[model samples]
Target: MKKLMLAAAALALTAGMGLAQDTVRMGTEGAYPPYNFINDQTGEVDGFERELGDELCKRAELTCTWVKNDWDSIIPNLVSSNYDTIMAGMNINEERKKVIQFTQPYTPGLPSAYAALAADADIKGGVVAAQTSTIQASHVAESGATLMEFATPDETVAAVRNGEADAVFADKDYLKPLVEQSNGELVWVDGFDTVKLGEGIGMGLRQSDNELKEKFDAAITAMKEDGSLNEMLKKWFGEDSQLFE
Candidate 1:
């Protein structure tokens, strides 16, 4: 459960305000496709998080706007008030809760997986790449493997494809699609271990923003009880995805 830390984790310390918040800023790493990415046609952020964040804002009576941030500085900028909430595909976990509060999860969960050029690449005790400050990177460090950190998820995948890394570890939702699209260039390593966590993904906010958290938490509860969240989960993450809440 990442709730990703930026490279400036030691420097990052960060909140939300609730007041029918006029144009609440939704911060995201727009390079992560499907979860969040800049739409080439409009040159604006678009993806599951974009759609989900907008709806959550509506239900919470807050007006929302998108703010794109680099993954490395994402948390620092949030602490600096560059945005009101982090809607990046961040997982809910203890490591990040110390600095930022989170609403109840919106998506059920996502699995962390490994991808490499070979179908049988050895993930254990082998070089693996992951986005810097992510859970996958931390997992790699603790596992009997060599960890290489990259500034972006794309670079991690590229590292494996170009022989800089033996394999790349990232969210399965993200890597699975890439493996499918890669033809035979890449594949998920058989028997590769994954980072284990039961937590779902949540929206990051300031720890002091209790009211804001309550507002979003209630909105999420409504979506789950009515099954709309699950419907969207299937649309973006496939029918097997667990329901939100």
Candidate 2:
């Protein structure tokens, strides 16, 4: 009996140590602007997701580390345990939910807009160009436009500007800057549909990690109630932002 009690105590001690050493590793694309972009000079991660990660760590009482991963590889890396969570501005959709768990949405999913360069004199109305395999691509395909698919957002934008494609559909947030930069070259068509866009973005975790998901969900709720989440959004997206308002 004495030996058995000693063994149990030793096992408990080891379990506690293992729990204490656990660190939450978060992954992001580190390319999307105002969401999870990396600082060009410091190579340090910075953006809304970084700030949100810090807030999540404070709430969960866990040490947090950020890992940079390419957008295309993020889901695979998460499944492989290359990271524990994903904070990139990834939309939570039924398709994605089939593989991973997502916390409560932090931002409201807004519709993407279709824009075309004014220089494209041959193009008549709103047509379609999009990054391949993206939600926007599907939207374009459904609209009956010959889908001009590209590898990246930059390429899609260039396609429209260079008249290779009539228009490009992208998230309103990303499209805003491009339209502004076009200096009157690109214009948003007023009637582009947004019904197919998925739900808002959220943190992605392994499907089996319910404990971490609960903790993160609770933290997000607390932040929303206390105004910290709104403050963070304002800091990055500007005051009068509509995301959480």
Candidate 3:
């Protein structure tokens, strides 16, 4: 009976290992750009995360596929096993660490900035729009501003353009191109200092999936060491983006 039990346990362990090597579903919000977004031209996931994720999978020798999830439910879905990993520009922080594990940061801490129609727009006392469940929303709530939460990042920007809010707070990387392309209609809010919240952006995995997390962490490190990661950052986020070195 003892010998039979050992054989069964060994078989179960092998099966678990095989399952771990199976296709990794990478979850992302196909909206945020310079990070991840649906390329209208390809009708598929594109942008920085898409490129970086594919390369990481290649280095990790993991078969992976992209899965789109709304930003608000990204973490919940990840924990529920709707996907194997989150590459949705999620920041690594203590609050999130309680529920999930994070791979070492892939990017340095990026600044969050406020955008508005006018440089003089009131950000501290007037209404500020931010995506729901985001660090920006939490910051706005605590900064004595009236916080208006939206379901998507685009909605937050729309709130500013539509006169619904005085300003929108979001990642500076994500907001830079928008301000430049706005034909001077939109500009960075003057006197509003950009803030870096959390540690940095990292891939989120389930607390139980240490093996998978290790694979990604190793891949990220390799990229950083090879300088491929820095090149990609500059390509997507412009030359001014922070580098690993």
Candidate 4:
């Protein structure tokens, strides 16, 4: 009877391993642009992260699919096995590292900036809008500013435009295009230094998936070495954006 029980456990383990390799579902928030977003024309996930994820999967020789998830529940869903990996523009920080393991950073450290209608808008101690559950939101919450958290990144900017918040704090890359398109209506808050919040953006995986993480890390390394990753960064972000050496 003990031998039979051992056999059953081994079978279950083998099956689980096979399932994991069959198809890797990459979870992402389809709201963050240049990182990840839904293409209105294609109605599909399309962005820098999406392109990077596809290449990573190809190099790893893993069958992969994309899954759209809300930002607030992304980590929880990953933990619950709703997806196998997270390719969202998640940063590698000690706080998040406690919950999930991260691959080598795919992108260099990115700065977060504050944007408002006026260049000198109050950002240090005024109401600041940020996407909920993001590092920018946490920064505002601890920086003595009243944080106005919204579910979507768009809504955070909307809050500032509508005068509900004094400024909106977010990734500089995400804000750059918006600021340009605003045509003087929106601008970076002058004198407010941009803050480098996290280590860098990386893929988030389950702690137990060490092998999977290694596969992706290797692929990312290859991309960096070939300079393809830098090119992608330039394509998504501007040429002035940071890049790996």
Candidate 5:
């Protein structure tokens, strides 16, 4: 009886993993709102990535499903084949491409910004918070400021609220909404230059998955040719998000 039970459990686990690999498992943090977040009402992944990924999968004729992962482990899990692709608003930076390949960037140019509790604060030579393994963190580390890395975006923002850090650097589009909702608790500060990082945001895939990469890249291109991609961008990021074409 014990051997039968153990075999059943193992079989179930293997079946589930096989299903994940058969269908394209779209991995995301589902914590970054607007870009990606869990809709409390629906209890599902609902945001730009959710919608965009669904559309891309449809265009590419692939069966895709969402998989939520921690921000810190996002890339590592992708490499380990825990999920098929990463569409977590990940920028197509050279540093990241060394480990994984990326489809054409889906997002238009969006700059990183800083936010803090103070209306005016200097980030120069001061402590700044950023999510670990992000471009923002790398920039802060090289800058004159002391860099404080957090595993999550919320924690990075919390560092500023707790006075542990002077400010948190992140995508302006993501931070702007947070600042507005803070009710005077947080304010945007001029701490960094609006430098272009990478091509833009793209879907991450294992380096060896050239066919998968081609499929997504072609799907993105098709969306660009059609007006559907632009409509999606407007719906999620607002009209401020320009058409990729």
Candidate 6:
């Protein structure tokens, strides 16, 4: 009887290991700092999203691996099975929802808007740079600014600083660091609204991966309930940032 019981336990352990080994391949731009950018020196991805993705993987009992991809091709790569999920700081919006599934938002919606040199004259409707294929680009075009699209957030900021673009439209968090680093070359414009900015950031998944989506959604919900999510937001974005408010 003892031997039989031992054999049964071994089988169960093997089954559990098999389940745990079902790897989840997650993708990120790895260029959006404070969220999921690659470390300049170490060359490894690190940021709030990297940490949060680790926690979510733990909660879901799945092995997770991250891959870096260009922002413009992220969604298409997901659709083509280049990865099992996307944990980049992707905003949940209707247009994105139409193409792929998203986990419940981990970060709340904060307004994205134009920012320019603090001393520069007010924007008079010239070329503006935004991440290509993003909602910000759509809004910029709608506002009658000629679109100068870029592949990453840093590039957009560079465009503004180099005088190649008049302004940049991007998330407040991303813009904040640039404004500080630019030595007064960038300042947020007034009158941006969160509502028009769309929804908060969430994880992206293949539209057909309902089971994985459900797991991620539940994990995020638990984090929110237990205050873990708020703690993370505070650590990265400060207490007064809209993410906490």
Candidate 1, 76-147: lDDT as tens digits = 888888898999888888888877888888876667888899868877878999999787888889889999
| Residue 72 displacement (Å), model 5 | 0.9
Question: In angstroms, how far off is 236's CA in candidate 4?
Answer: 0.9
Lowest lDDT 10-mer window, candidate 5? 190-199
lDDT of 6 by residue, 132-213 (tens): 9888888888977788999888899898889898778888787777777777667776554232477889899988999999
Off by over 4 Å in 2: 1-21, 119-127, 193-196
Candidate 1 regions exceeding 4 Å error are 1-20, 193-195
CA deviation > 4 Å runs, candidate 4 = 1-20
Q: What are the runs in model 3 whose C-alpha is more than 4 Å off?
A: 1-20
State, as a TM-score between 0 and 1, how close model 6 is to the true structure: 0.87
Ten-residue segment with the worst summed lDDT in candidate 3? 189-198
Clashing pairs in 5: none
List TM-scores for all candidates, in order.
Answer: 0.88, 0.83, 0.92, 0.92, 0.88, 0.87
The superposed Cα distance between candidate 5 and the true structure at residue 128, in angstroms, equals: 0.4
Lowest lDDT sum, 10 consecutive residues, model 1, at: 10-19
lDDT of 5 by residue, 183-223 (tens): 98999785453556657899999999998899999999999
Model 2 worst lDDT window (10 residues): 118-127
Residue 245, model 4, lDDT:
79
What are the per-residue Cα lDDT tens digits for candidate 4 across 22-100? 6899999999998999999998999999999999999999989999999999999999999988888888889999999
lDDT of 5: 0.87
Once fitted onto the true fold, the runs of candidate 5 whose alpha carbons sit more than 4 angstroms away are 1-22, 191-195
Model 2, global lDDT: 0.79
